[model samples]
Target: MEKKQLFRNSVFILFFLCAAFTVSAQVRVSDFRYIDNIEGYWTMKTKLGLYAEKWKRVDDHTWKGRTMRLQNGDSSKVDDMRLFLEGDGIYFTIAAVRDSVGEPIRFKLRVLKAVGFVAENLQSPYPQKITYRWKDTKHMDAHFEGKDGRVSREIIIQYTRQ
Candidate 1:
């Protein structure tokens, strides 16, 4: 009976540890920032064109984001997004709908490339990967890549803390 009790206790502890690890792996949305800083409205300019967006933290590992073309200045309808922080790196996903009525219409936004030995490079990174990069406390660059591989652009956004 004692052996059985010990085995059951071990199983309970293992389960508890697994739960803790799972929770820790998830990044909260509220902590979303470019690089590791620069939060709030951002503007990005790329070879394609200019775009702007408002990034607001919704939770610890989640953020509410909206991107608009510079010409129209109208917000794109984004459904949801998830943020993850890896070792020395941050990643996020923006649920974008490419077409009005297409199946499997959602695409992911991820950090594909990191340029610069220092985070303060003035020239924007190439081949848009993540939507935002923290160049410094006051400067950031927002990047957007399309799902179809037909459209990809980068925007250099400078910001001030509100």
Candidate 2:
């Protein structure tokens, strides 16, 4: 009789857990899709210098990356980056590589196409945009553009697999 009661209690607990999971499963996970497409070590070079970007999947719907400027034999962190999907599309946030003292700048991947994705943060100084355009499997270009007051700025860095 004791054995039968223990078995029934176990079955009841299992059923409750399954029901809980089913209810929570209706919630969505992050949707960082294009990220998986660009998961690898990437390096960019331009007239100014060289930069490096690295990406890796954190989970099904989240990816994290780091960027740095490299010169001679030394490298410095450009930014710490994160991409994740909350509702419809992916969102991006970036912070200083060494210290995240301030609020992170935020952006949304509002534009995603076959070629690439663009993330932009619109603020008073002028919206800053980062674009990753794919040329082919082994080549791509990462561009950054912004405008403050009357000054306009743009940087295009050509990238290849490293």
Q: Score every model by TM-score.
A: 0.39, 0.68
Model 2 scores a TM of: 0.68
lDDT of 1 by residue, 1-162 (tens): 999999999999999999878645444333334323433666656565555566666655454566555544544543444444445444444455323444322223222223211111112223324445555655665444333354454434544343
Model 2 clash pairs are: 31-85
Worst ten-residue run, lDDT, model 2? 23-32
Q: What stretches of model 1 exceed 4 Å from their correct place?
A: 1-38, 45-50, 70-91, 97-131, 144-162
Q: Report lDDT per candidate.
A: 0.46, 0.73
Give the number of the best model, judged by lDDT.
2
For residue 113, model 2's alpha carbon misses the true position, in angstroms, by 2.2
Question: How many residue pairs clash in model 1?
Answer: 14
